[model samples]
Target: MLVLTRRKHQSIMIGDDIEITIAAVEGDQVKLGINAPKHVEIHRKEVYLAIEEANREAVSDVARVDLKRIMGQLGGSE
Candidate 1:
């Protein structure tokens, strides 16, 4: 991992699109401000992991469902 020390208001750029700035430092906590395009997604690591896990579980459940049987029950054509 590439680690760099940045003081408050200092910024680091990623590629040509994203900018990560050190907004504030208070005791042990550091606040960051990120500037990026609207298409870019930003999430905390734990939140991202949870979303991935939930998606996996949803896919697994969907795989176990019988789509044909449900369609038949609804009187829909195959």
Candidate 2:
């Protein structure tokens, strides 16, 4: 993990475009502002986890095919 200390109003640039800035600090919580191109997606860790989990469930449901349904669609004996 690349950890650095940044005070309010200071920023760190990433690569050629992305920038992360410290907006405010209150006790143990901090607010940050990110600047990036519209094509780039920035997601919080928990949000990503939830999206991944939902995708996994959908994929698994599709993978668990009903053999009977397939045979009926094919007009073949089960």
- Best model per TM-score: 1
Clashes of each: 0, 0
Residue 69 in model 1: lDDT: 67
lDDT by residue for model 2 over 1-78, one digit each (tens)?
A: 999989999999999999999999999999999999999989999999999999999887876666556767789653
Clashing pairs in 1: none
lDDT of 2 at 74: 87
Candidate 1: which stretches are off by over 4 Å?
A: 66-78
Q: Compose the digit string of candidate 1's lDDT tens values, residues 10-61.
A: 9999999999999999999999999999999999999999999999999888
Local distance difference test values of all predictions, in order = 0.94, 0.91
**Cα RMSD to native, each candidate?**
3.8, 2.4
